[model samples]
Target: MGPESAGSAQRSHVDRLYHLPMITPQGGRRSAMVPDVEVDFGAGPTTVPSTMRYVDLTGNGRIRVPAQGAVDWSQLNKLPECITVEWSGADRGVVEAVAARQIRFLYWHDASGTVDLTGTGVTDVRLDGIGLRSVRLPESARVLLLREPPESLEVDAPESGHRMDLRLFSRGPDIRIPGGLSRVSELWLKVAGTVSASVLTGLTDLEELRVSFDDPPGVFADAQDLQAHRGLRTLQLDDAYDWDPGNLPELPSLRGLEINGTRRATATVVKARFKATDVRISIHGAKSEAWLAAHMSNPFRDWVEDSKPFGAAACEAYTRARSAIEALAPTASDRMAVAEHALRGLIAALNAIDAEYQLIDTLRREQAGEVFFELAAQAEVPVDQARRWFADRDF
Candidate 1:
């Protein structure tokens, strides 16, 4: 039959059985059938019983369903293992159906209102859009990404060996990470509103953390709580306004720390606090002597250490360039002259090295360019002027 005629027949079939009520797992009643639906089980669309009309099985035990109207999903003979639902409004039956079947992975998009999966066995969930009033995930969840901030959120502690990597974009003051979720190992929070770092109290196992804010008071409220994560190895804090770094404890495990767009005092304090440690610190927006010294100590340390036997000349050139930049005077004009001469010398040295070793490939050239610009930045050369500084280079 043609598509229109088949659709009409399907509607007629569902209309005849629309009066039948299906009992949900919660003991509530809802319509047994939805009309004019096709199930695509990976291969192609196929006709299914009217009672299973709204659900489209897309193979590998994954199903796509709509949340626009009331339909009793519990009536299905078999439920898919993974489900993606585009929700328009609150549907307690949908949540109950997922909970009843223990859906493993759920991608709920364009949803609003509250959804509490407190007792479900869902392991992976990705939620998007705004207007979420509250959400509660079960302890079984291991991977979660919330694209919009919900007003209230609660997540149970994740099971061991199933560490969760959570990324949250939050702008609501009410949103806070519960201490119970201590097993979160990697977290990224991009905030526009205030969020307390007290949330990090019990996340002792966190190895990497990144926090960025949108405006003043950009830092977390009680950022000192970060010290609790003794295992944290990498941290990036951006747009930190008036943050006091003195309270930040020394993290023995920290190998890399990047602080960008912070106040001068905070940057200086961070430089002082982490200098003696072997941590690689990258601070942006501050041209203080400390920042320059920390970054310039050896910009080419890795390259020099890993250089091949044939690349001795290139390594020496890199070392010489670094030395010249480090000795630059504090004045901008003196810095410009010293940096330009050092860059020219490095270029000449690289040209001679490439002539003999053929080492200046596209990758090497890009790497050299990055190092050059970083040196320029360290010299306090304006970026536009720095670009022109390299205009005459031959290498």
Candidate 2:
């Protein structure tokens, strides 16, 4: 037989069941002996062609894969491991800035009532003034900073890589560092909030730090009183963290120092003797704040007991909401709805809070208008008081 005849005869029993790559054009002929380019083993042993061979296989052994006309499973095999996944558990989010080796820095704006950022892989988050309920950074994260109040920004060390800077943006000097993160490989820590007790338990290995106190009470007076930063060689005390300049210390190993007293520390005795090292002491409170720091009231008196970890704005909002509700008349209905809606489902729990504002916040996010109307319609309370209470709110 000729080559064409042999080819046609061998493809007589070729079937499309098992594997079908492409049907042969010759198989369209009148003779049943025509060959088929695409063929499988379903046609029995007689369908075996002399061409294309299969990978090593024998007996009942089977490996379901995408090869030799099988379905492709490469995508499934390429998925990253579960450990590299970040789960931002909370609903409301403000993923202001996100940077990763796998993707470009994703800067997101928050306009939606509820922001969801559960898909950011192995999150390395950095944000400021974002109104998020919470954030969870993966263990693969290098640097996970919650510059804004993130309610609770949980960082599982190995998930992120924050070698450059980790800042907690607060208008004051107070912050909470996770106790779990025993060692911070980061080089600089500029906290814009209060540095409460044990909050620095995680920064045993930081190289440089500049912490601001939300409460400029000057209680953190002595640097020696601070939980020592073993690797710390430089320090910066903003007006929030400064006490009396005399109380400040200049370490022998200190390579750089910035004692930003501005004007707030001038009255306190916040002296810095950076005689031996390369320390830069900049007084940045009154003069440094050459411009006055905006006088903003504290927000948290109930939601986050000064001891708790959460966002300052969250507390501030709650505080404002409660104050407004107190000044409001009980008849306000629309205002109540706005507050409750803002709470979504936390209205009841918030109401249970001793600080009436927590519950009022639920109302604020819901129908705060109701509260205002009620207050306005009331004849008993002074109307001017209610007006001042809601002066800063969006209504």
Q: Give residue 389's lDDT in candidate 2 (0 to 100).
A: 42
What does candidate 2 score on TM?
Answer: 0.38
Candidate 1 structure quality by residue, lDDT tens digits, 332-367: 566677787888778777777666655454335665
Candidate topping lDDT:
1
Question: Candidate 2: where is the Cα deviation over 4 Å?
Answer: 1-102, 106-123, 127-141, 147-154, 159-164, 169-175, 185-194, 214-222, 264-272, 285-395
C-alpha RMSD by candidate, in order: 20.4, 24.5
How does residue 346 of candidate 2 score in lDDT?
27
lDDT of 1: 0.59
In model 1, state the lDDT of residue 41. 27
Worst 10 residues of 1 by lDDT: 18-27
- Candidate models: Cα lDDT each: 0.59, 0.38
